[model samples]
Target: MSSVGDLGKVKRVETDVVKCKSCGGTMVFDPATQSLKCEHCGNTEVLSRDTNVLERDILEGFEKAARFDRGEQASFKCSNCGAVVMLGADESAAVCPFCSTPIIVKEEYFGGLKPQVILPFKFSADAASDFAKRWAKRRLFAPRKFKKTLSPENMHGVYEPAFTFDSKTRSTYRGRVGDRHTRVVGSGKNRHTETYIVYRNVSGTFDKFFDDVLVANNSNFDQKKLSSLLPFALNEQCVYEKKFLSGYMSEVYQKDVKDGWTDAKKIIDANLYSAIKSTLHCDVVDYLDISTEHSDVKYKYILLPVYFSNYRYNKKDYNLMINGSNGKTSGKTPISPWRVLFAVLIGVALLALFIYLYSFAE
Candidate 1:
């Protein structure tokens, strides 16, 4: 239970900075060692985690807005691609990892809610790049140059912005479902089978609890393509620490919490519809209209690890996403014109051979 008084006390909390003891250089979170590593001295510092992941009441969070001052991290907005990038506080300059365009720091942009839990990158940069190369090798239509010239430079380890929602919903639905049936009528030439659907009015109450429904908050990237890299091990999350963001770049959430919840409900409704349909146990559905009442809804703004990169082919850019937790890769590449032509030729040859075999059999 929370009151308005609790809203006043709720504010953005900052994580402590992790510095290298051996050298004066700042330590960054390294996925390979699961510790903070210094770029200048190669010193590794271990981080302790004990915080349990908690889901905040979505309705209550709207009452108190939290904002954190930029202490040890710098925020940059890409002018060309409109990406909000966060970098180390000591470093003042950086290029946009998505478009390779120069980014300038913006002071007015308020960083969104601090992540409570983060699934750290499980794959190193070299390993992620290797996964991308292997994935591309299976894509027969991918251009030869794209695979041959593919190097690790295009891959970047990024902390992508996302929100996870939990909710208990009670939906009262009313809809019509149909089952297909066939009937034979008349005789001889008039004897024909007619297919018709038998419709029935149905109403039911559905109660469901959705634990985690992940939604993307970044708009700069292709969301559908990003979703292809799913099944991230959310159970392996740790308390969000600034050290975890040491070497990687993080994106500021462009979507607001309110909007994020709205999107979440859409996903919930779709899942609920499927659940209802499954309960009905019908082969076909003509139409279904459902009205839902959601309660005990909670959400958490978190950052997930991803190895994002892009490549250019024929003056067009194709984006790639690698799941940082499991090394799953998904991306778009330019299709080779020669490969399509060769496939067409092979199909024609096969058709000709089939026609000759049929004629000989006849």
Candidate 2:
């Protein structure tokens, strides 16, 4: 079935939010204040955390499920690099932004449920900028221009959507088990020979509850790279409140629960396999295949917070991420060509000096 998000004219419409009526001006989420504050209007709008709870569970056949995009997003396809791009509100999208490919947001169909929870901007533009600067400083190999020019103006706090899941699993399996031991064959030679015997049958029931089995809503960012900057203060996360999105740049879910749930299940199943293996706790095994079934599954749609920025240096794109909830940071950085060349030259010169000194000693 088509979702409500997919039916709209794909072009995302930026809505004009009203200021806190008490104070007449733009109201936005303030990280330091941890509340919505109006700068021009001086309206103090407070956010309340709902007492409602979210469910986390493993959905059946998560990997095999439909992978589709559904929400208000402009899909950018880069013919130069075969990269598809998406932009958010805080993003000062100039081009491919990362690859410098000229980008234009065009509306399109998105087939996903709206997020139920959101962790608002606890980290602001200034915070993100400072974080980026410190991050560049730590990167010893990063190009000077890339770090200096890649200002916070290039940074944006984007609310990326994701699904977290939990599950109970029962797995049945039959495989060969191997135990390693060495036996002395000849007393005179003292030679040792290794032997193996396979154990036939294995079956077990395993259960584990997963919290925040996350599947990303954004496709532009690599999942592994994104996960490196994790633990998005999900516990403090509240139900999706638009008031949080005010004055910030963020993207709605392009990937829905149905599709995201599929990704979530793969994560759960891997955990399930680990749980089952942990339950077994055996030394060695061969030809292992296990099938699992899931039950009592529940899911929550959440908009997790993230700060994203990408820089292009020496014709390669470097993406950086910051955890929006806490100040934790993670991502890949580009090394400067000059730095590498200079190091190599110094090493070569040292080697030449060492050879000359060795010749004199000889």
Candidate 3:
């Protein structure tokens, strides 16, 4: 993470390239176990972390996002895998999909907008495949052949883009809350009586400050899927530096700053309302009428690491993802009913054999 030249104190980079000397396969970020793993063949390498970093004004980052042009994955060679590649308008692949090597070469000027901070990948490709296997093993209904055929080579490490926002807000709210209690009334057969009381004339000003609310700067990744890759260690974030992008392919922030900020505000408002409503100290939660206004909104654009894999089973394809920083794994795997049945049958056979042996001994 040491600063070099114009990258200043805010830039962080992997000092050494993770390579598999045996196969020369580029090491990729793996979400499971948080390590640098070579997927072509099972190999793991050590990576050190330097947490010194900086923060950006979330709003300004968004404004710049407005002036930026959408960048395409033009002809470029991968530093990790040595692939001279081209991609569709939507794709932002970091490595060569065929060779399983990192291929994304840094652009001198990637659409004019530069990343403010980065979440360097800690996990390697081999670890990501292991994560996939562990994840696959739990799928009781998944196909056995597909499980065995699950290839780690199908996975790629892509740098997903996002904008984190910080803001101060004040909201005016009016809401109703209710609590239920029952009373027993009656004969030999017990009957329950329910009572209702309404809350009215509720109004208050809710003010809360948000430090880091996330917004997807890229449209490709699903919010649910993207959110699975959390705990970005924003504390380790540094200012915009090109060195970090040297050997990795990065995605341009597709969603403009306005959209990102709006998204961030929405997330913040939802949490803020929940906080305010809970702070009201009501036993039951209900009808909420709240309006929020944003002030002093700030933001940062970042490239976070992830291991992505796609597999086909039963004519359907599944995408699996792992968090590059901490190895938190998420993705759908094919289920096999045969495997489940076989496992159950084996258990039953073992029990029967044990009983027969006991009888013979007697």
**Clash number by candidate, in order:** 0, 14, 22
State every prediction's TM-score relative to the real structure: 0.82, 0.73, 0.72
Q: How many angstroms is residue 46 displaced in model 1 relative to the true structure, after the best TM-score fit?
A: 1.4
Rank ordering of all candidates by lDDT, starting from the highest? 1, 3, 2
- CA lDDT of each prediction against the hidden true structure: 0.73, 0.62, 0.64
Candidate 2 Cα errors over 4 Å, as ranges: 1-14, 56-112, 183-201, 345-362
**Model 3 TM-score (2 dp):** 0.72
Q: What TM value does model 1 have?
A: 0.82
Model 1: per-residue Cα lDDT at residue 159: 77
Worst 10 residues of 1 by lDDT: 1-10
Q: Per-candidate RMSD vs. true structure? A: 8.8, 8.3, 9.4
The reply for model 3, stretches above 4 Å from the true place, is 1-52, 67-73, 77-84, 90-93, 96-109, 149-152, 186-190, 195-201, 283-286, 339-362
Ranking by TM-score: 1, 2, 3
Q: Global CA lDDT of candidate 2, please?
A: 0.62
